[model samples]
Target: MSLAQWHNKRPPAATGLRLDFDDGGSEHVSTTTTSSALSLLSDQLATQFDRYKNEMARMFQDHVRIVDVVDRVDSLLAAGDGEAAPDCQREKEAEASNAARHGAELEERVARLRAEAAAWHPAVKPPCPSL
Candidate 1:
């Protein structure tokens, strides 16, 4: 999965991410924002957050801060992945497309009927004498 797909943004044509090193060196990333990259970043941040919590526990032994941080992170991740957004727009677009197709079919049928009617003419002879 493309991490960028989470936001539905069109990927840039040139996604070169440049990183500068501390020793006057630099590296360029031709590709980024893949699922693996996101997973790695998430793991690293979680580790750091765990360390922060441990340090706070050592200093003040606060359990409330841990709960608060977990709740905040859960909500943040949900928002980041668009879990709170509705999928109504896609449904509406699909309905509109089906309606357009049905309208086109109706138009074609009407045109065919009109053409047949234009070619139709009254019978030259009377009804059969089967009566």
Candidate 2:
């Protein structure tokens, strides 16, 4: 969910009663008025939640990719003791290491973002008992 999806202003449907009044002295006079401001908070929040989940999944994918690379490298290193070229072995090891580090970094970022999102999410209340 991109932040762009959220509405910066309330929606027309979300509007509620807004009351106002005025008092006058001497002759004595009074006035009142009301208005409502709609909102799209719920929809925005849902989008944000979905985005968070998507990003987390992407992070998990990164980790899986790294693991796969490492496994492949291990296989190549073991399959042929002499067949594996020095440059090929070095490149595979480096690529595997880089992928692993990137995966870890992505995971860490996802965790922190999720934590932050959780903090901002509304508190859930217990269900009300039936009358």
| Model 2: CA > 4 A from native | 1-39, 82-131
TM-score of 2: 0.33
User: Model 2, residue 48: displacement in angstroms?
Assistant: 1.3
The sequence of per-residue lDDT tens digits that candidate 1 reaches over residues 54-74 is 898776645677888999998
Candidate 1: stretches off by over 4 Å: 1-86, 122-131
TM values, all candidates? 0.30, 0.33
Clashing pairs in 2: 1-51, 11-38, 11-39, 14-38, 14-39, 15-37, 15-38
Local distance difference test values of all predictions, in order: 0.72, 0.72
**Residue 19, model 2: Cα distance from true site in angstroms:** 9.5
lDDT of 1 at 41: 91
**lDDT comparing candidate 2 with the true structure:** 0.72
Please write out the lDDT profile of model 2 over residues 3-82, one tens digit for every residue: 66565643445223322222233112221221111135566788999999999999999999999999999888789757
